[model samples]
Target chain A: MIFKIAWRNIGRNKRRTLLTAASIFFAVFFSCVMTSINRGVFDKMIDDSVTSNVGYIQIHKKGFWDDQVINNAMVYDQQWKQELAAIDKVQTVIPRLQSAAMISFGKITKNVLVTGIDPAAENKLTNISNRVVDGEYLNADDQAVLIGEGLAKKLKATIGDTLILLSQGYRGVNAAQVYPIKGIVSFGVPALSSGMVYMPLAAAQYFYGANNLTTAVVLDVAGKEDVEEVLPPLYAKLDTNNTYEVMAWQEMIPDILNLKQTKDSSNKVVTIILYFIVGFGIFGTILMMTRERQYEFGVLLSIGMKRGQLAASVWIETLLLGLLGAVVGIALAYGLAYYLMVNPIVMQGEMAEAYTKFGMDPVMPASVALDIFWEQALTVLTITTLIALYPAFVIFRLQPVTAMRS
Target chain B: MNIVTVQQAQKTYNPDKIPVHALQGVDLTIEQGEFTALVGPSGSGKTTLLNAIGGLDLLTAGKIIINNQDIATFSDSELIEFRKQNIGFVFQAYNLIPVFTAKENVEFVMLLQGKSEQERDTRVRELLTAVGLADQIDRRPSELSGGQQQRVAVARALASKPQFILADEPTANLDSKSTADLLDIMLELNQKENITFLFSTHDQRVIDRARRVVTLEDGKIISDERVS
Candidate 1:
C-alpha cells in the first residue's frame, strides 16, 4: 500500500517528475554516447595503426627491432610459416625483408623504407590489394614494385615506369636493382605515403644478397582483447634457446598509447563536470519533493505511519523515477549508437588533415557495446539513489505537529 | 477505567528565543468509552494538551500515562509505535492519502500493523459500512465530498482498533449538514462499539453533542461540564 502510494505520488505532479527525469535521461544518454564515441575513436586508431602498417603482433630476431639491417634478418622457410599459421588465434603470418634504400627516377633521388613481401600473404594480413589506386598489384614472381602515391609524385613517376634502387645488402655488399612500378597507392598516414615502397620478397632478398631470410614475421589477431591472450601461447611455442622478440602494436607505438591515455584522462574531467551538474539537478528536485509535502508527511506520521516506513517509501519513489529515466535513456542511446557504428561520421576540413598527419583515420564512430549501456545507466541510477537521502533525512527529523501546522 | 492520564502537562515552543508556553501545568483524565471535547480559542493549549496525550509532542515538564506506561519514558520511535497501536488521529483537513480509495485509506493502518489481507479487507468493509460510506469504497478522497472524506477518516481511525481516537478540529472544514452527519456517526461508534473519542475543537455543535466538555482559556482549564 505504501509502495502504491509512492508510485502514484511520483505522478502527482507530472510536470515536476518529467523535469526531474529529463535531467537524468540526458545524463545517461549523453554519457553513454560520449563514452561510446571515445572508445570507438581509440579502437579505430589501434585498428588502423595495426592493420595499416604494423600487424597485431610482430616476431623479430633478437636486436633486429632495435637496429634494422639485412644481416639481422631471420632465415626461415615455408615450413616455418606453416607452423606459425597452425597456432591457435593466428590468422596468418606475413614475412617481410625490410630495409632503407635510395630510389632515383630521372635525378629525383629519395630515401625510402623498402619492404619486400609475398603478395598473397601480405594481402591476407593488410589488404594491400584494396589500397591499390592504379595498375595491378604485385604477383609472387613480378620484379615490379608498389610505391606510395606521395612517393610517386615526388619521383615524377607513373605506373609501368622503371626506378633505380640502390642500397648496401647483407655483409655490406653493394646492391642495385631496376624495377617497374606495379601500382600506386595512398596511405592514411602521410609519413608512410611520403617515403615507402613494396616489392616481391624473393626479388628484394636476392637483390639484398640475403637468401631465405626475412626481417620479421607479423601475426594478425582479432582485437585488443585477444592480444594478451594470444601472445603467451605464441611465445611458449617458439624455440626458447633461440633469440626472438614478440611485440604487440601497443609496445611498438608508445606515442599512440600515450595519446589514448591522455584522451581518457581528459574525458574523465568532462564526465565529472557533467555528473556534478546532474547531481545538483537531482538534489533540487528531491528537496522540493520533500519540502512541498511537509504537511502531508506530518499528517501521515501523526496518523501512525512510522518514520522509517515513510522514509523508505520516499526513497523508492526516487529510485523508480531514476530507473525509468535510465532505461529510456539507454533505449534511445542504443538506437543512436547502432546507427553511428554502421555509418561512421567522416571528418572533414583541417581535422582530416590533422588525423592524417598523426597517422590515424579521420572517421568518428560510436561503439554499441552492451557494457557501455550498463555502465552509464548504473552511474545515473546510483546518483539518483544517493540524492534521495535528502528526503529520507527530512522524514526522519519530522516533528508531526509542527509540520502539520506548516 | 481511565485510558489516558495527564498530570501537570506543559509544552513550550522554542525555549531559547520567544518561548510560547502552549500548555501549563494541567491535569486531565480520559476514561474508556467516553465522548469528550476539548474546547478553546486559538493558542489556548487545547490542541497542545491533545498532542501531548497522543504522544505527537512532548511536554516540557509533565507526564502523560497511556495504558499505565509513562509516555515520556519512551523514545521517539517507540512513541510512534505507541501511537500506531494505541492512538488514532483525525485532522481538520481530513488528511486522507490523496492516492488511496476510501477502502484503502481505512485499510492502511491495519496494513501497517501487518494484518493479513483477509483481516484488513473484512475490517475495512465493516468500518466504512459503519460510517455510511460502504458504497463509496472505491472512490478516492478527491471523489468524495468533505463530509464523506471526514467519515472515511473516522473509519480509518477505527480500523486499527485503537484505545482512543484524537480528532483535532475534525469538523472545522465541514458545512453544518456535514458536521451533523459526522458527529452522528462518531456518536454511534462511541455508543455501539464502546470506543473512546477525545477531540479538540472550537465548534459549538461538537461541544453540544459531547458527553463531557472541557474548556480552556490562556493555557489553563476555565471550566469542565458534563451534558446528559
Candidate 2:
C-alpha cells in the first residue's frame, strides 16, 4: 500500500518530477557520449602508433636501445627466431638493424634513421607494401630503399634514383653504402616522411660488416592488453643480467600516454561538477515534495502511520525516478554512439591537423561499451539516494501535534 | 477496562523564561466504547492535553498508559508500533494527501499496517460509504468539497481500526453546514461501531453533539459532565 501511495505521490506533481529526471537524463547522456568519443580518439591514436611507428611489444638487444651502439645487437642465429616463434601470443617479430645515417642525393643531404628489415618479415608484421604511392615494392634480394614522399621531394629524387648513405659502424669503423630508391612512399606523419628510410636487413648488415643483426628487433602482438602478458614471460625466458629491456608501446611513447591521461582526467572533473549540478536539481524537487506535504505527514503520524514507513515510501519513489532517467539516458546515448560509429564525424582544417600531429585518426568513431551504461546508472542512483536524505530526516522528526495546528 | 489513561501529565511550552503551562499534571481515564470531548476556548490547553495523551508529545513529567502499555516510557519506535495499532487521528485541516484520491487517502492507514490490497479496498469502500463519500471515492482532495474532504478524513481515521480515535477540532475549518453533517456522521458511526471518539475542540456544535464533555480552563479541567 505504501508502494501505491508512493507511486501516486510521484504523480501528484508530474511536472516537477519530470524536470528533476530531465536534469539527470542530460547528465548521463552527455557524459556517456563524450567519454565514448574521447576513448575512441585515444584508441585510434594507440593503434596508429603501435602498427606504423612502434609495435605493441619490441624485443631489443641487451642494452642497445639505452646505449644505441651496434655492438649491443643480439646474435642473429636461427635459434633466436625459433624460440621467439614458440612464445605464446607472439604475432610477428621482425629482426632489424637501425642506425642514424646521412643519405645524400647530388647536392642534397639529410640525416635519417636507416631501418634495416627483411621485406617479407616486415610485411607479415605490418602492411608496408600498401603504403607505396609512387614506385614498386621490394623484390626478393632487391637491394633498394623506400624513402618517404617528403624525403623524395626534398632530395629532388624519384623512383630508381641511387642515393648515397654514410654511417660509422660498430667498433668506430667508417662504413658507407649506395642504394637505389625503389619506392617513394606516403608515410603518415609529416616528420616521418621527411626523416625516415627503410632497406633490406641483410644488405645493410653486409654494409655494416656485421655477420649478424645490429641492436634492435620489433614485435607485433595479438592484442594491446596482451602486451603485458607476453612481455613478462618473454623477459623471464630471455633474462640475462637485466641487460635487455622489453618496452611496450605505452612506455615507448610516453607523450601519447600523457595525452590520454590528461584528457580522461579533465573528463572526470567535468563529470563530477555536472553530477553536483544535477544533484541540486533533483534535490530542489524533493524539497518541494516534502514541504508541500508537511500537513499530510503530521496527519499520517497522528493516524498511527510509522514515520519510517512514510520516509521509505518517498525514498522508493525517488529511486524509481532516478532509475528511469538513468536507463533512458543510457539507451539514448547508445543509439547516438552507434550512429556516430557507422557514420563517423569528419573533422576538418586545424582539427584534422591536430589529430594527425598527435598520431590520431581525423575521424571520430564512438566506441560502444556496456560498462559506460552501468557506470551512469550507478552514478544516478547514488546521487538520487543522497538527495532523499533531507526529506527522510524531516519526516522522521515530525510531531503530529504541531503539524495539526499548522 | 480503560482504553486511554493519563496520570498526572504535564505539558509546558517556552522552556527558557515565562513558560506557558499547557497540561498541568492532568489525570484522566477514558473507558472502552465511549464518545468523549474535551471542550474549551482557544487558550485553555485542551489540544495540548490531547497531544500528550496521543503519544505525539512527551510530558514534562508524569505518565500516560494507553491500551495497557505505558506509552510515556515507550521509545520512539515502540511508540510508533503502539500508535499504529492503538490510535487513529483526524485533524482540523482536511489532511488528505493532495496527490491521492479519496479512496487512496482512506486506504493509506491500512497500508502502514501492511494490509493486503483486497482487504484495504473493501474496507476503504465501506468506510467511504459510511461517511457518505461513496460517489467521490475516485476524486483527489482538491476536487472534493470542504464537507466531502472532511468525510474522507473520517474514513481515513477509521480505516486502521484503532482502539481509540483522536479528532483535534476536526470541523474547525469547515462551514457550519459541513460541521453539522460531519458531526452527524461521526455520531452515527460511534453508535454503530461502539468505537470511542475523543475530540479536543472549541466548536459548540461538536460539544453540543458529544455524549460526554470535559471542559478545561487555563490548563486545568474545570468540569467533566455527561451532556447527553
The candidate maximizing TM-score is 2
DockQ for model 1 equals 0.74
lDDT by residue for model 1 (B59-163), tens: 999899999999999988888888889898988899999989999999998888999999999999999999898899999999999999999999999999999
Model 2 misplaced stretches (Cα beyond 4 Å): A1-7, A76-79, A171-174, A211-214, A317-328, A357-359, A403-406
Instruction: Kindly provide the TM-score of model 1 when superposed on the true structure, using C-alpha atoms.
Output: 0.90
Tens digits of lDDT, candidate 1, A1-406: 7689789888888997898788878888888888888888888887877887788888888888889787888877989888888888888789999999999999899999899998998998788899899988999899989999899999999998999999999889999999999999877666788798999999989889888989998888776677888788888977535788888888887877898899888877887788789789878878888888999999888877898899889888888777777888899989998899999889999998898787676789988889989987778768877888888888888899889888
Residue pairs in steric clash, candidate 2? A73-A215
Model 1 chain A: lowest-lDDT 10 consecutive positions: A237-246
Candidate 2: tens digits of C-alpha lDDT, residues A129-188: 888998987764778899988899999999989999998876667779899999877876
Q: What is candidate 2's TM-score against the reference?
A: 0.91
lDDT by residue (tens digit), candidate 2, B1-228:
798888888778886888988878788889887889998888898878878777888888878888677887788878777777778777777778887899988987788789999999899989999998899999999999988998898888888898878888898889999999998888888898988999998888888888899988888888999865
How large is the i-RMS for each model, in angstroms? 0.9, 1.8
